[model samples]
Target chain A: GAGVSQTPSNKVTEKGKYVELRCDPISGHTALYWYRQSLGQGPEFLIYFQGTGAADDSGLPNDRFFAVRPEGSVSTLKIQRTERGDSAVYLCASSSGLGRNEQFFGPGTRLTVL
Target chain B: AQTVTQSQPEMSVQEAETVTLSCTYDTSESDYYLFWYKQPPSRQMILVIRQEAYKQQNATENRFSVNFQKAAKSFSLKISDSQLGDAAMYFCAYRFNQGGKLIFGQGTELSVKP
Candidate 1:
């Protein structure tokens, strides 16, 4: 079975540049999630999407972070004016939308803002 | 807000020995899910085990098992016969029944010695 996958395993950008990270969840998964993990720390929730709508985006640190899952299958996390503080590994996960269903995670995109 | 805590930052165990990782979470919600995830050097987050707050019985998966104490708000993972492949960062996470976001604890790095 195909697992969750993220594009550009590593991305390095300038302090003020824009970057986009993509995630392809498992087929038929209706619940998608995004998280940011810093070194030596656990993954922090960023956003969650159910179907084509974002059910939660409160975890996003600031307005600079935005994500979209327009068609309900693939998702894109966009960052505007990336900052050095934004450097971290961005992880994506997906589940079957059932309560208590396990979330399968992607390899993640390591974003480094220089 | 819910918070998960992993007091041990690092732990080491000889191969084939058992090692336990402790995790405690603070949450007002009665119904929620607890999870233990492993991240190897590959940086892929793999689900280790899960426990439901409502279930009194602990959850076990192969060499991985969890001692889930809802009353104590404690969830610990015990790895039996730890292998070198088990060396990784272990994280404890929590999610409500509504499944909006996951609150994660600072990871515990485990090293398996030969």
Candidate 2:
């Protein structure tokens, strides 16, 4: 695709339900990132992947939140036993390379927990 | 840890006028990158402009320019001849050249009046 693409623009799930968000980054981009944005707040970094390995997972809020980029192209963010506080827009971005490269973002997945 | 701050929660400007959005950041790293992203109602995060901390000259992209003060650790966006389409949430972001993670500010909501 020309730009980073995220699946299921919106998702509504009950608390404690498991949810998975998918992200397809731009072709040839080696770096992918996942972020969470609450209402009236900026996006918070969740995880970063360089190729197939997670370069940084320190930003992941807790064990309930996990992300994977197995093939170095498409990434998936999984939330287990989701809580009401998990309700937010999940954004996916990709950059061509590390170090000063501008990242391209997707439209984001708005997750609403009930 | 690096932190980015956008103090103005909201700002408004008339069409064809100019608007400036302020941003400040704290980082011990000498080499880093600064960015301004626009997120409209559509929820797409768009890159407006970017500045390299090592560069002495400011960066400009069409009507969008930045007043980057490296010494003060401030990067402000100046929009010339603002348009209704420019109404969106502007985010200030920082990233270290060595580390790939991007630290974002609280964001400023921009409203362009007719």
Candidate 3:
């Protein structure tokens, strides 16, 4: 079975630009999550969705960050006016959403803001 | 807020030897989950092992196991008969039993030497 997958393994953009990272969770997964990982650091939570609606968005750093999962499937993390501080790897994960099930993660998309 | 800590920034172990990576966390919730994830240079996060806070018995997966001390707020990963394939960055993560986001530690870079 295919695990979570992210698109554009690497992306580079200038500051103030806008970018979108996409994630395709495993089929039949009811829970989806996004996380940001800085250099030499572990991943920090961003947002989580359960069946198309976000269950938690408190981990989003600022208003510039937003994510959505439509049709209870694919998800996208959008950043407005990207900053150099946003340069990090964006990771996507999915789980069965049943009783503390383990999450399956993707390779992650590395975003670089110059 | 929950926090996880991995004091060891790096650790090296000889092949076929045993190695333990330390992790500690602070949380008020009695029921939660702890996980160890391995990230290779490929940047893929893979589940190593998981321990439920309510489960007094530790969790084990093949050569990988966890020593979970709920009262001490400690969770450590022990790898026996380590192999070269085990070389990677290990992260300790925590999530509530309610299931939302994950709080991760700084990570421990493990190197396996022959």
Candidate 4:
């Protein structure tokens, strides 16, 4: 079975620019999540989607960060006016359902904002 | 708020030896999930083991096992018969049964020696 996949393994952008990262969850997975990992730090939750709607997005750092899962299988994380501080690995994961289920993660998209 | 901690920044073990990685988490919730994820150089996060807060018995998978102490809020991973392929970054994560988001700790880089 195909596992979760992310597009643009690496992206480098200038500050103030807009960026979008994509994630394709495993088939039949109803729960999707996004996280950001800075160097030397653990992954921090950014957003979570149970289906087409976001179930929880409190982890999003600021208003500039937004995510969406329209059809429930694929998701996109959008950043407005990117900042250098946004440089990090953006990880995507999916699970069969929520609550205690093991999540399968993608390789992650490394975004470097200059 | 939940916080996971991995005190050891790095650890090394000889092949065929045993090594344990420490992890401690703080959560107000009574029921939750703990996990250990391994990320090799490829940067793909792989699930190692998981423990449920209500279960008294520890979780084990092959040479990978966890010593989960609910009272102590401790979840440690022990790897026996270590192999070179085991070299990677290990992260301890926590997720509440009510929410789908995962809170991760700073990772420990494991170096398996031959």
CAPRI rating of model 4? high
In model 4, what lDDT does residue B10 have?
A: 100
- Model 3 agreement with the true structure over B43-105: per-residue lDDT tens digits: 999989888899999999999999999989999999999999999999999999896788999
What is the C-alpha lDDT profile of model 1 across B24-104, one tens digit per residue?
Answer: 999999999999999998989998988889999999999999999898999999999999999999999999998667888
**Compared with the true structure, what per-residue lDDT tens digits does model 4 show for residues A1-114?**
489999999999999999999999999999999999998889999999999999999989999999999888899999999999999999999999977788999999999999
Per-prediction TM-score to the true structure, in the order listed: 0.98, 0.98, 0.98, 0.98
DockQ of all predictions against the true structure, Cα-based: 0.81, 0.90, 0.81, 0.92
DockQ of 2: 0.90
The 10 consecutive residues of candidate 3 chain A with the worst lDDT sum are A95-104
**Tens digits of lDDT, candidate 2, A1-114:** 889999999999999999999999999999999999999999999999999999999999999998999999999999999999999999999999988788999999999999
Residue-level lDDT tens digits of model 2 in B12-53: 999999999999999999999999999998989999999998
Q: What is the C-alpha RMSD of each candidate to the true structure, in Å?
A: 0.9, 0.7, 0.9, 0.9
Per-residue lDDT tens digits for candidate 4, residues B24-98, read: 999899989999999997889999998888999999999999999888999999999999999999999999998
Task: Report every candidate's CA lDDT.
Answer: 0.94, 0.95, 0.95, 0.94
| Candidate 3 collision pairs | none
**Residue B59 lDDT, candidate 1, scale 0-100:** 98
Off by over 4 Å in 2: none
Task: Report fnat, model 1.
Answer: 0.82
Docking class of 3: high
